[model samples]
Target: MKNAKPDLVYFSGFYSEATPFIKQLRAEMKDVKFLAGDGVKNDEFIKGAGADAEGAYLSLPSPVYTGEAYKTFGDLFEKETGIKRDASPFVAEAYDAATVIIRALEKVAQEKDGKLVIDLKKLNEEIRKTELDGASGKIKFDARGENVGGETPVSLFQVKNGAFEQLKQ
Candidate 1:
């Protein structure tokens, strides 16, 4: 099978499972292109696979740790945690989630008879009506409580020189 090599090999699993396959494939067929799922699109995968991780491709929602919009959050997070970590898609999603929840609560919470009362039903309605420009991008929900546009923009990246390089298409 090594002699009859394919042009592309794809791995659709977590970094733990994909890294070993990448390493084995690197030893067997160094030139074949490796495509992976979002699970292997992190620093841990690169660290685990070493040089064999280079030139590998993966697709992820949103740009990782890029764009001027995320500079403040990234800087503050690094300063507070003292841990420099790659900004993954989850970070943006989390920010948007928190924003939506807080915004909805603010709209539904009321001071009634010297007591703070929150209407749960109203909060849900507010959440469905949420529209805000977030670090990830514009966030708006449909009646089904899903992002109006369905999925976020997916960007393709290639591992180059031990770092993720976004491929502009």
Candidate 2:
């Protein structure tokens, strides 16, 4: 297996990543920086998070957002030498997933029949064809929403004296 001395102890397959690691991490009482929803496939690890840890995982309909809308998101970035971008199909898919569902609901609600009649086949088609404008711009769904997005590199940079200054992105 892995013989490397890792500075970062990443639990990739959170669902299958096992609970022992989570228990150990919790018992250790150190701050456990988690990316559980960022494509961690281990079911056990994901299941281990507390009910209050809902926001800790990344999945469709994650309710995480900045309290101040339209404000710069620079302060939420990691300032290490490395930069993380999330243009993954997973995120885009999630956005698309949300959009399609919303559109389907809207479509179903508009019918004059009054009673809501949700068509799963039509819903699936709409979900497949979702083109939505979400918090992260346009999102299009493909093949059951397994797609994701890469980080935006923290934007909204500042200009300094006729020059450009890089902010968080």
| Per-model root-mean-square deviation over C-alphas | 4.4, 12.5
In the range 43-125, model 1's lDDT, one tens digit per residue, is 78889999999999998666344555567766766788775545443666676689889988888899999999998889999
Report lDDT (Cα) of residue 88, candidate 2: 28
TM-score, candidate 1, is: 0.73
Q: Write the per-residue lDDT of candidate 2 for residues 21-134, one digit (tens) a residue.
A: 545555553444433433442232334544323223233222233323202222222233232223222443354456568877776544546766777777777666666445
The local distance difference test score of each candidate is 0.79, 0.42
lDDT of candidate 1 at residue 96, scale 0 to 100: 67
Going through the candidates in the order shown, the clash numbers are 0, 29
* Residue 29 in model 2: lDDT: 35
Candidate with maximal TM-score: 1
